[model samples]
Target: MSPAHAGRPGQAIQIGRDYYEGPLHICDSVTSLLAHYLDLLDRGAYEVGEGDDYIGFVADPYESGFDPELLSGGIPHDVPSGLQAVLIQVNAPRSPLDLTPLAAAHLRRLDLKRRPVTDLTPIRDLPIESLAVSLHDGDLAPLEGHRHLSSLDLATNTTIDLTPLRTAPNLHGLDLSQATVQDLTVLADFPHLRYLALTASQWASLLDENKVPPALAAARLSKRDASRTEALSWAARLGLTVGASFVISGTLTSDSETGRTQ
Candidate 1:
């Protein structure tokens, strides 16, 4: 009933039927999320808990094995007061989620999985260390004040400019695998950025231009069909000098210009 927290990246802990890692890998299934929360509550997991800082809530009528009775009144709006991270995903038509209520000095991470939000203004002042979100309007203007953000994983349905994040001094890791960045050239301005994940085309452009951020220590190219040869070549050109992995191995000519993964 008591699950220890995995404090570092790439580590995982088991909670009920789910595996808990960092904020992003919180319970994914709706049924499992509810069961884990209830079980944790009964075990007093919320009392100065370790990994209980991360919680996930989901309410999707179409989700497999979903039962309405488990959340009769709809998704709970309130979260544990001392919670440090939260993941909320609701598959239904509704207004943007209001984050003002969730803002707290103790909160550090948040994952609003594909849920539209009013804006980033509510949490700008909060000491957020990491964020994973989907921007409906692709506006990053509200991110200027987040000086403590160390990681950001963005999902966009459309192309977006990365210029707004240039001012964040503490940003060390960025994930744009699910986004279409208008200008990856802006990444050069981030002196602290050490890890980056981008589409194949984006990485290729960086290689071609010889503009890979000098501070980068690791990178991930998001292309499903890209051959191991192509990826290794790309990394070599970009001065990555690291081993690369592929989901599915296939031959790819240097002329391949595919950008989007999906």
Candidate 2:
């Protein structure tokens, strides 16, 4: 298909089984795009088009007996030309995996959640805007120079130093939930940061009015303790006047400022 006939070549496109006739269009979210691709893979109808841009594949070891090698080979060679985002989710073998096929200089986003990948030296120079990875004692020095990065998810990484993030001036959203970071002072470097997530216990440490970034707008606290009164109290002090939501036994219940479960 001609570049003009196909929607904007830069628009995000999710690879799926559906026989789409024209250029791909943007999807509502990356999660939905991944679901469409997984459905296509199940139906054995997924095909990579020449004009395709963003694409993702998820392999569930328990359900589909996912083979990392097979998934790697399935990626088309043309994907490197204009591909923007490449999300790969794999299970088992907690070791770094080389994703040479998906490595493109123009790539803008990458999500390797729950994957065995540890080393990120390969794509360190790419102008990526968003990145999510699960690293276990892996070197994070590669991320030090990623100034274009805006959204980062290091939730699965336990041991990490926030010092490297000082260079990422464009960072806006960050996820450090379940991480082993002890210092909240490092966040003062991110002048543009607005959204943050961390363990409930870390809320107290970040409550220091002088330490919290002025632009911080919202926060998601996971692993919440039985009583969130202290957390909410801290939030109130930080000028986060918004209400809170509580997840109990997988059921989310909106809570008012009075601590009443709505």
Candidate 3:
């Protein structure tokens, strides 16, 4: 099989049980990673790969905790329907950094463990044809150069600002839930976005199919349980004017700062 390439932000690339046939591109920054040189890597160690058929990569930091052996070398994650992509989680114990030298390693590259208390730069522009930003159930820092994103899943990352995505003309799918974002004016800027899902109280307002733009077609919104909902109610009560035809799930928070804690 050729080098495995990651999909665009939200698009799916054709793949077999062990191959990803996207645009067949890779990044120069990755091929140079130090992890490429070691014939054998330590579990929870950094990984690397050559560009060849490789499109881009994902960085899940949590994986290091669940499977310490994943860090030893390239970890390929083949999702349902022959879909190949990376699945990185937050940082956990026994995870390494600086994986830029293992040319033989084409990794699933899950886990984004490296997060600073003050800030985190958003992803920058890359040549990736198909990529999946599985920031699901996680928090995302500021994103940078994302010029070639196609399928992006910011789901569960309610705090992330999708405005930067306006630059990604190829974006098709987007998901942001459980995050702190109140409005989705950023999505209105995209002319090509096709599918979107906001399954949280925070970003529910962005699902307005009417005012959200014509490119949008399918969407789903879910809220947390009574033990879950919080500031989202204000948007609904105030009649912020969002989308329709979607069942409202999740909980609504109490009134006042007293409930701020447990």
Candidate 4:
């Protein structure tokens, strides 16, 4: 748990099996249980700070200390300025969500988890550079002219089309660990892509078709299985650095080693 989630009887932050108990009140929410998250923006609690990647918020009562009334009240309508990077994890039923309110100029990174956003038209004009979102099997067509989108991470339970994403001129990194695609040839459309990640099964299908993206600098596989050896061999043949991540006792761990294959 992050420092913000541990609210007190005995305040403790867990770090690699060690717990540090202290007086820390980082919960930015006004109420002990979340009435809404817009209050955090008003209080200037949404900023991720100078060098931090992002400031995260958990909307699931089971996952965090507070209850996010997202079911009763939808996501905040407006994301205030100066909030560069923000990640909100939600637990709710599948429903349409409007993302136009989050299209702030200074907001470079936005991550929405478990969101049932079916349309991307609302965020078509966002100036965000990085986006990690749950697609609800959403189409990537709305991002056609998104020039600043350098990185995109998608979470979907079904296969999605990658043809729409090829329009991004600066797209360098893509994560499709939770998604699948029938046509691996579309990956060649991304001319500037350097990093790619996919599930072991997806990689196998690509390898069998001989359609791995040629310009990739690195690749990561989502699961560990017999297919990993073939992936490593494929990466080696392409002189690319490869890695894999898997769950070990409910803890996420990686077995990635640095340096490119000769």
Best by lDDT: 1
2 against 4, candidate with superior TM-score = 2
Task: Name the better of 1 and 3 by TM-score.
Answer: 1
- Higher-TM-score candidate among 3 and 4? 4
The residue-by-residue lDDT of candidate 3 on 1-262, one tens digit each, is: 2343443343322334554333322322333333432322434344445755532223432222223334333333422222213334444433332323212333332233331221222223233334344343333333334555566544333365556667666677765553455457666777888876664543445444334745766654544453223334534533455444355677677758677632
The TM-score, computed over Cα atoms with residue i paired to residue i, of candidate 3 is 0.42
Off by over 4 Å in 1: 1-20, 23-81, 93-95, 240-262
Q: How would you order the candidates by TM-score, starting with the best?
A: 1, 2, 4, 3
Q: Write the per-residue lDDT of candidate 1 for residues 1-262, one digit (tens) a residue.
A: 2332323343322334453434232333446566766776676555443576864334333222222332221234564444455556554554566677665434567777557664777777766788888777647777884677889999877788888788988889999998878888878888889999988888877767667777998888888898879877877777656574547767655534665343
TM for candidate 1 is: 0.63
Poorest 10 consecutive residues of model 1 by lDDT? 64-73
Per-residue lDDT tens digits for candidate 2, residues 1-262, read: 2222223434444335662322233443456556766786887654555679643343432123222333341334444344555556446555665656556535566767766556777777777777887776675688896867888888535556788787877889888875677477788778788998876666667765367776888877765463578666666777767496676675657677667664
The TM-scores of all predictions, comma-separated, are 0.63, 0.61, 0.42, 0.59
RMSD of 4: 12.7
Best by TM-score: 1
Question: What TM-score would candidate 4 get against the native?
Answer: 0.59
Candidate 2 residue-wise lDDT at 121: 79
